[model samples]
Target: MSRVAVLMGGRSLERQVSLKSGARAEDALERLGHEVLPIDAGPDLVERLSTLAPDVAFIALHGRDGEDGTVQELLDVLGIPYTGSRVSACISCADKVLAKHVLRDRGIPTPDWHAFSETAFRELGAAQALPAIEERLAFPLVVKPAGQGSALGIKFARTAADVPMALVSAFSYDRKVLLERYVPGRDLAVSVLEDADGEPRALPIVEAVPNEEDFYDFEARYEIGRTRFVCPAELDDELTGRASELAVAAYRALGCEGFARIDLMLHADGGELDVLEANVVPGLTETSLLPQAAEAAGISFDALIARVLELALNRA
Candidate 1:
């Protein structure tokens, strides 16, 4: 067994979730008979990694610096192998604006959206373009931070009047904000994992049904029992195939490797599915969609962790 450093609990808003994921991963690593070193990633990350010098880094960190290529670059400099996407892939997955552009450019179906940086709105009078944007995308827009995951800085704007406060909520989490057309329907997620032959395969689809809220926000995601999850998503043969295909396409288009979870929305009216965002380091908590999908696909939690670590080691 090799020495593994599980990085988690950064200063992001998703810190708690990352900690949970790290803890679970640690348990699995221990059970697999590997030495596990849990690191609460902070300013002393370099110092700690240098002193410890683990064989591999199993990143359980989420949001901001964790998923935005900051730590990946550091790992590269330290000559350490890390799990998940590379620097460019992390950059693409961490920013919602970039992810959507990549999906659209690859001929993948994503929701119609617009991106605005703080400079554009605060300095260049981008607010003047709001009316035109609303006219194009229509009402009930999904305003979200361009760089946040786990639905942290997402808000709904039912009308033109709601856009400002929604923008405020989104900009608070990130400098850039993504304004997307809301598809009022079922919540779906598909996790992609690499096969033994190094092929990316989409796991069974998982559907999240929020018990109380109209949207699956932060609380609905981590606070268990707030939502009900259905593995295989009850989709028909054709729908399942399409969802899986889109997921694999998104994964490859974003240059993701090892593993990733693709979140999507299935529209009720048109029955169309649109890509929301890709999570590079998905949560491993009890309620996280990836673990649930893995279980449905007959891969146990410990086995999943082992597979992820194996992929990283093999790549190195």
Candidate 2:
């Protein structure tokens, strides 16, 4: 068995959640007969990693520097193989605008979006940007930081009146923000993992049914019972298969390897489905979407963790 170091708990807004995912991953890795060490990533991350130097690094981090290629860059410089996408892929996926552009260029179905910076919004009256955005993306748009995870700095706006507030909230997280056309319908996520044959394997689709609000937000994601997870998404076999294919396509289009989660919307108007965004290091907690998908695939939590470790080791 390989000695593995699972890194989590970074200087990001999702530190607590990362801590929880790391703890669970540690337990799972140990159960799989592997030697494991759990490290809380911080400003001293490089120093701490140098001291532990394991066979591979299992990154269970989410949000900010954790998912935005910072950790991957350090691992690359150290010549250590870690789980998830490479530095370039991680950075590309971390930026919502860039990912959207890549997906759109590939003829993949993604919501229309416009990138706006604070300087542009404040100095240049939103009229130019607003009209352009209005022409492409309609009302009821989604405002989100171009680089964030775990639902932080995400807002659903119904009218232009909500633009200022949404912009401020999203800009608070990152300098770049995306205004995307909101695709109304069921919220679903598809997890993709590369099989031993080096081919992408799409897991079962997971439907997110909000218990209280109209959309699944941060509260619904972390708070217990705030959302219902229906495995296999209760959709027709055709739609399920199509969604699964679309998800894997998005993953490959973004050049992500190991594992990733693709969020989608099954449009309410019976139109074509739309891709929301992709998560490179999807949450590994007990309640996260990837774990839930694995459960539906008959892979126990321990087995899922083992699979992730196996992929990391083989890639190394």
Candidate 3:
């Protein structure tokens, strides 16, 4: 039992989801007999943390300032150890484009993709090069804001004509946008937790199967019953091991500490698995995937939260 500040509800686009995550974490902390101080991250975040002087900060915030290294750095400056990844990992994982680049550099399997900034499209005439990129990546691409999470600004471009509108919508959320080749297959999530040896181990893979034949968008993700999550993903032993190994590799490549969630796509055609991105501060809500994966791995929700808190205290 320690003084733990659960940070949530930031000004980011994922504010609502973050609030739910933070509330859940706070409940867990209370159940575990820890004094919890829930803080809605905003302009007075540093001020509140300084005033409260909590021993640790359990970050339930997602996207933007929450996952982009902003809040983590502030906590570091205040000398409060926090749960989840460090500042560098947060920076790398928060930006979809940067995380993919890191994955590629580490010889990890990630989908082929391209990124563009709003400035590039408007001032530098990057739009004219769309046809070339489209030809290279092919049709039915996924367009998303480079830094937003909870699939906030994701769009599917089924054809060349759809690309412009998708980019516009994505750019509305973030200055940078990523266009990736669509892998028509199973959407899988691998949650990685450190073992006793401090080695990252992959939890049971959770496959998100949408009820309708459509993209697993934000609505389908957060809203319960919109998508069915199959624990262990119904994969064969060899494929499961391969997926687990890849998940660990991605976690280590990003320098993530404590825990993280790696999202991957398994191709329906050849079963080629490729990582999409890493979520440094994965959700902890009732319908979140990380908890379900943990549960499938035989870890209860309370135990999972306790383990995460213990890991954060290890920095001391």
Candidate 4:
């Protein structure tokens, strides 16, 4: 058994969620016979890690400093092995605009998007740009911070009047904002784990259907019953396989390692499946997609944690 540090709760909007993830991961690791240390990553994370050195860091962080490669870089500098994507991949995947550019270049199907700053939108307003944007991407585009997760500062603009407010709100979370064609479809997510053999294994696909809301928002995602998840989602076998393949492809294309979750939009019209985003550090809570998928794959929570640690240790 290795000495593992479960790191979580950074100075990010997802701090509370991260703490929960860390707690779950910590418990799972302990049950698996690993000597584990749980640490709340705050502003002085570097100082804290310097003192409590561990063989590997099981990063349970989400958003901002935790998910954006900052913590990964710190671990790299400390010569400590951590699970998930490398520093560069973390930055590329965390930034939606950058990830889309890479995906588009690779001929991956994704919604057409445009990135703009708040000042540009404020000065130009909607009449000049909105008309053309509406024509190209159309109305009902998605507005979201270029680098964020858990649906923070995300808006669906269905009308011209909503564009300005959406831009303002999205920019508040991140200076760069993404405006993309909103694909009307069933929301689905797939988690992929890279085993010790360096092979990527896609887990069962999960279909997320928000009950009241049109899309999964912060409240809908965390609040029980707000969204219904169908694991091994009821899909045609071919569709399910395709989604799983696309998920693994996306994970590799973004340079993610160990494990990652890819979010997708399967259009209702069956036109095409669009990739939304990839989460290198997916939630580890009992109800999170990654854990649920693992459970479906015959891996218990403790076994999953042990596998992740084994992968991290090998990297060390």
Name the top lDDT candidate. 1
Q: Tell how far residue 114 is off in model 3, in angstroms.
A: 1.2
Candidate 1 backbone collisions, by pair: none
- In model 2, what is the error at residue 147, expressed in angstroms? 1.4
Off by over 4 Å in 1: 213-223
- lDDT tens readout by residue for model 1, 1-316: 9999999999988899999999999999999999999999999999999999999999999997788899999999999999988899999999989999999999999999999999999899999999999999998888999985777778888889989998999998889998998888888999999987669999999998777774635445546677788898998999999999999999999999999999998998878889999999998999788998999999999999999999999999
Reference-based lDDT, each prediction: 0.91, 0.85, 0.89, 0.86
Worst 10 residues of 2 by lDDT: 214-223
Better of 1 and 3 by lDDT: 1
Worst 10 residues of 3 by lDDT: 214-223
Across residues 209-274, which tens digit of lDDT does each residue of candidate 3 receive?
888765735456556677888997999998899899999999999999989999999889987899
Per-model clash counts, in order, read 0, 0, 0, 0
- lDDT winner between candidates 2 and 3: 3
Q: What CA RMSD would you report for each candidate?
A: 1.5, 1.8, 1.5, 1.8
Off by over 4 Å in 2: 123-127, 213-223
Candidate ranking (lDDT, best to worst)? 1, 3, 4, 2
